[model samples]
Target chain A: MSESYEATVTDPVSAPMTCDSNPVEEWLRMDRMPHIWCPGCGIGTSVNCFTRAIEESSLDRKNIAIVSGIGCTGRVAGYLLLDSFHTTHGRALPFATGLKLASPKTKVVVYSGDGDLFAIGGNHFIHAARRNLDMTVLCVNNFNYGMTGGQVAPTTPEFAIASTTPYGSVERPFNLPYLAQSCGAVYVARWTVYHVKQLQRSIREALEKPGFTFIEMVAPCPTLFVRRNRLGDGLAALESYEENAVIKNGADTRECDLGMGGPIVCGKFVDIDRPSYLSNQVAHLRKVLGDRYVMPDAWQGVVQ
Target chain B: MNADPRGVLTGSHFLDGDHAAAEGALAAGANFSAGYPITPSTEVVERLAGRFPFTGGTFIQMEDELAASIAIQGAVWGGSKALTVTSGPGFSLMMEHLGYGIMTETPFVLVDVQRGGPSTGLPTMPAQADMMQARWGSHGDYEIIALAPSSPQECFNLMIRAFNLSEKYRTPVLLMMDECVGHMLERVVIPSPEKIQIEPRRYTRKGPDEQYWPYSLEECNNGDLVPPLTKVGEGHFPHITGLTHDDRGYPAMNAKSQAVLLGRLVDKIRNNADDIITIEEDGTDDADVIVVSYGITARVCQPAISRARAEGHKVGFLRLVTVWPFPEKRIRELAGRVSAFVVPEMNLGQIVREVERCSQGRPKVRGVTHAGGAVHDPEEIYNAIREVMG
Candidate 1:
C-alpha cells in the first residue's frame, strides 16, 4: 500500500474526467479515456454506437454487464461504466455465459474482436449459440489481430495482406452472419461502423431480443489492417472499405458469406423467438417435478 | 456465516471421498459449480447435479475443463461462491484459468481429484503426484492454498476449510484428493447449519462516492484477509484483468509496475503463511523415524507407523492438510529432532522432494515408490521406516 514501487505512469490518461454535460460521458469512464485505440480506428466508432444503444435501450441500467476478451474491441469493458469483466483472450463468451446463467436477470454482452471470437474461442461460440443462451455477442470484425500486430484473422479476406501474411492470406474467411445463423442464434445482424444510426438501432434491437443474439460490426483496423493492405487510412478506408456491401434483410445465411472483393451481405438476417437455456431448463424441470420443483428467486440457483 | 440448512444434510452418512466433498461444498455455502466429468472427480459433480435441484444449488456441466475452470470465476464475480471439480487430465487443462483467477484475484475453490499421470497414466487409480503441480502448475509466481484429505471424513471437513481459505485469501484453494481417497467410502458427519462456520467474503467499506480500487489495501485492517471483494454487479465499475495491474485493477505494461503488482500477489500468501499452513502430527515425541504422507497415503502410513512402533523403533506420523505453504518451518524443526523422514506416495516421488528440500540434508529422507495403479503396501512402508531408522 506504500509508494514503494509506483511506476511512472508513462501514459497517465489525460486529467480525470470532470463532471460533464455529455450523455456518453455519463455512461463512460472518460478518465480511462484518451484510450489505447489509434487515431482513425473504427473500434471507437463501434464503442460509440454501443454506448448509444445502451442509452436508448429500455432495459434497466443496473442490469447490464459487459464482458470482453483481449483486443481493441475488448477495451470496451474498461471504458464502459457498467459491471464489466475484461476476461482472458478468446474467453469472453464462456465468461459471459457464466454471468448470465448465475444472474439470469442481468443482461450480459460479449464484445470482442474477430480473432478472439472465431479463432481460439470458436468452439465456445457455437455451443453457446446452440444452447440459445440469453445474451448478446457483439463481434467487431477488423480482419486482423490489431492488438498483437496485424496477424491474419479467421474473418480476414483471402488474398488480403496482414503482418503474418505479408504476401497475402491464403485461407478462407468465416462469414460471421452465416456462422451465427447456422449455429442457432435466435437473432443475427451485421453492419459496418459507417452505418452509425442503423448500427446503434440494430444493437438496440439485438439487446431487446432474447437467446444468443449476435451482431458482427465490420470495423476498419486503420492502423494495422488498413496500412498493411495499402488501403487508405482514417475515413478514406470507411468510404471505400467493403464496397460491395449490400443490405439484405432476409438473404439465405449460406449465401451471405463474405468473399474476397465480393458482395458483403449485411442485415438483421435472423430474428425468431426461442426459449433460452435457463427458461428451457426451468420449464423442463417444472414439467418433471411439478409442485416439487421450486424456482429460485433471482440469483439463488446459479448455473452449474 | 453459517451453512445454508437447505444445502446441508445434517446427519451421519456413509459416503465416498468424492461424495463427501460434494456435500462439504454445499455445507460450505457454495451455490454454484461448473465441471466436466472425469474419473475420481465425477461423483462430486454427479452428486451435486442430483442434489442441487432440491437444495437451491446450481450445477453446470461445462463443455471442457477450460470452460469449467473460467466459468466458476465468472460465477464468483457475479456474487456466488463457486467451484469446479476435475482429475489429472482436466486439472492439467485448468492450469491456465488457475493463473487467470489468481491474476484477477477472484475467490473460488477447485478440487483436483488426483490420479496418476504425466499424461493420463492411470484413470481410476490414486496418485499424490499433483502435489507439486498444485503448487506450481499454473504459470507465474502467484501462491495458492492446497489441501490433502486422508479420509472421506476429512474430505468433507477439509472442503469447508478449503472454501473458507479461498474466501479469506481471494485465491483458488485446491482440494488435492487422490483417486483412492476420492473413491473410498466412510462415515462422514454433517453438522447442523448453525454448527458449521463459513467465511463470508469481506466487502470493502469505502462508499460509492469514494474512488474504489479493487487492490487498494490502505484500509485492509487485517493481514490474513486480503482486500475486500466487490462483486461485478455492485456498480463499482470494477475492472479486473489478467495483465499485470495496479491497485485499481487497471492493466499496466511496465516492469516497475509489474514488480509492484507481482510483489503483492506473492506476498499476500507468503506473509499469511502462518495462518494458512496446517499440518497434523502424532506420536512424534522421542521418535527416531517419522513418516510424512497425505491423501490416501496418510491413511496408508497408519499401519506402517504402527508396525515400526511394534518393533520398538520410535516412529511418528506427520500428515499434510494444507500443502501449499509447505510447512517448511515445521519440517525444519522435525528434521533436527528425528533421525530420518520416510515418505510413501502413489507417485514415484512428488511431495517427497518437499520433504527433502525442507530437511536440508539434516536427516536421512527416503521414499517408498509406486507407479500409482494401487495404494502403497503397508509392509513396504514399514520396511522404508525401518530402513530410514537404521
Candidate 2:
C-alpha cells in the first residue's frame, strides 16, 4: 500500500468539520478526503440518498445511529454525519440490531453489502426480520464482492463468472425481497441505482416504518462485476437497469422477483403495523420499574 | 493454622451458579437484565425474571440473543446497571454486538456459560473454546475484561466484581463459566447488600440542560478511567455507534482519530490491570510443583491439590479468578518458584499457554485437558501433580 492508500484507509471522517458544508456534510470528516470506492460505485449514490433521507426525516442527528459492516458499501456509515458505527465484516446487522434494541428512540439503519448480509449475516438478517424489529436496512447489492476482489456472492446471478469461479457461478442468487418478506419483514423493496429518486424514497419510507424494513439497491460494481462479466462500463449497467427495470406501483412484495425482473418492485413492500421489540420491552420495564420510576426522589437517597 | 476453611463463607442454599450470578448483578445495583434462554445459562435469565420486577429493575426475555445483548446496553444507557447471559452459541451470536460494546465503550456484563462448539458443537456440554474468541473474535484490536469463577459463591461475588470493572473501565466485562459450573447445584451465600461495596461510574450532572458527551473519560476521584454517563431519556448526553469515535461520541475514521480512540480503549484496561486482575495462590511459596486452573476445572483441581499434598508431594494451586487482565505478574513470580506447573482444564489447554509464557522456559508447564461434559477427575489432576513433582 502506498502512503496515499494507507493514508486514505486510516484517515476516516469524524465530527463533520468541513466548512460551509451543509450541516449534514459538516458531520463528515473532510480530512479523510477521497474514499476507497471504485470510480462509479452506486454506494456513493445511496450515501447521497441516505444523507438526503436523514435530512428529510427530521430526526435529531445525534439520536440517529448508522451501522455498517465490511465491504465497499459499508463505508457509507463512515462518511455519514450521524452516530454511525463501522463494525466488522458480516456483523453489521447484529451491531445495528443491538443499537436499535438498546435505544428505541434512536433510528438505527444498517448500510451494508449483499455478501455481508446474504452470505455471512443471513441468520441475523432472518431473525431480525422475523422478530419484526423496527430497523432500516439498506443492502447495496452490487452483484459481486467489491472488497476482496469480485467474487460470486449469494446475491450473484446464477451464471456470473468472477475471480473465485473460473467458470460461471452455478448457485442461484437470493431474491432478497422475497427472503425478507418470508422472514416476516414488515417493509421490503428492491431498487436499482438508475432509479436514485425511487431508492431515496424507499429509504425515507423504511426509516419511518415501524418494523423491520429491507431495501435491496442493485448497485453496479464496475471493478468486479462489470470487469468480470465484460459488461460495458457503469453507465452501461445503469443504462441496462433503466431499460430492463419495471417499477411496481403498489407496496407488494409478491410482485417483485430478481430472477425475472418484472415490476422491479421499488416501493414500500410491507407496511402493516406490528408490535416492535423495544416498545414491548419498554412496557415490561415500566411494569417492573414501577414506583421507582414514578418516584425519582427515592433513587437519590438510595444511591447516596 | 487450621487446614479446613470450608465454612469461611456465610453459606446460602438453593443458590446455584445461575441464581448467584443474577443475584450478584442485582446486588451490584444492576437494574436491567435482558436475556434469551440457552441451556446451562437459562437459569440466569429465569432467576432475573423472577427478581428484577420487584426491585424496580427490568428483566426481558428477548426474541433472541441478538436483541437481548443490545437491550442490555440500551437499559444501561437508560440509567441502569444492565446485564445479559447466554451459552456458547448465543455468545457467538452476540460477539458482533460485544465488539460494538467495546468500540462504543458501553458498560455491561455478558455472562457466557460455556458450551461445546466450533458450531453448535455441544449445546448441553461444557467447553472453554470461547476463551480465545472472547478477547480476539471481533475484527479490531481492543481489550476487554473477562472473569472465570470456580464455585457458585465466586459466581455471585465475581459478577458484582465484573459489573464494577465494567463500570470502572467503561467497557464490556465477560463472566466466562462452563456448563459444569453454571448448572452445578452448589451452596453460594449472598452477602447482605449493604456489605457489598457497590461502585458506579460517575454520571455527568454538571447541568441537566448542558451538552453532555457520553464517551468522554472523566478522571474520577480515584483517578480511574471512566466517563460520566448520561442516559438518553434523562435529557443529557448523546450516544453514538461502534465507530472509532472522539470524546463527544461522534464517528471518526482518520488515522490520528483511530490512534486516539484505540489508545483510550486499550489504555483504560491496560492502565487499570492492578485494580482489576484477581487470583488465588495456595501453598505456592514453598512448593516445587503447582496446579493451575479456573471455573469448575479449578474445583476439581482443588481436591487434587489437597490429595497431592497428602501424598507427600510439594504441590500448590494458582486459581485464576480474573482471567482477562491475564495475571501475568503473579504467574511470572510463581514460575520462578515452582519446578513444574500442571494446568488441568475442562477445555483443551486454553490458559496453559499463559502458564507457559509466564514460566519463561524455567519450569515445565503441561496441559491436561478434556472437552466433554464430565468434570475432570480428582485423581487425574492428582496424578499430573505428582508427575510434575518428579
Best model number under TM-score = 1
Q: DockQ (Cα-based) per candidate?
A: 0.50, 0.16
Cα lDDT tens digits for candidate 2, B1-390? 111121122346676788888778777777667788898799988887766545555565666787678767655654567889998889988887898788877789999999887787888888777888887877789888999988778888898889888877778999998887787777777654446776767677657556667666553555555677665444443536566678877656699999988887888888888889888888888988888888888877778788777878788788888889798888898788778999988778788988898889999998888876677888888888777666
User: Residue by residue across A1-304, what tens digits does model 2's lDDT show?
Assistant: 2553333222235634566655446556454457778766788877877777767876776666777777888777667655555666676775565545445667778889999888887877888887776788999998888999988889877677878986888887787888998898877778888887888787888888788888889888876687568766677778878887876645556556554233445655666677776555556556876554421222333221
| Segments in model 1 whose C-alpha atoms lie over 4 Å from true places | A1-23, A299-304, B206-210, B222-225
Query: Model 1 clash pairs?
Result: A304-B59, A304-B60
User: Where's the lowest-lDDT run of ten residues in candidate 1 chain A?
Assistant: A1-10
Error of 1 at A250 (Å): 1.7
Report how far residue B96 has shifted in candidate 2, in Å: 5.7
Which run of 10 residues does model 1 chain B get worst, by summed lDDT? B218-227
Could you give me the TM-score of model 1 versus the true structure? 0.94
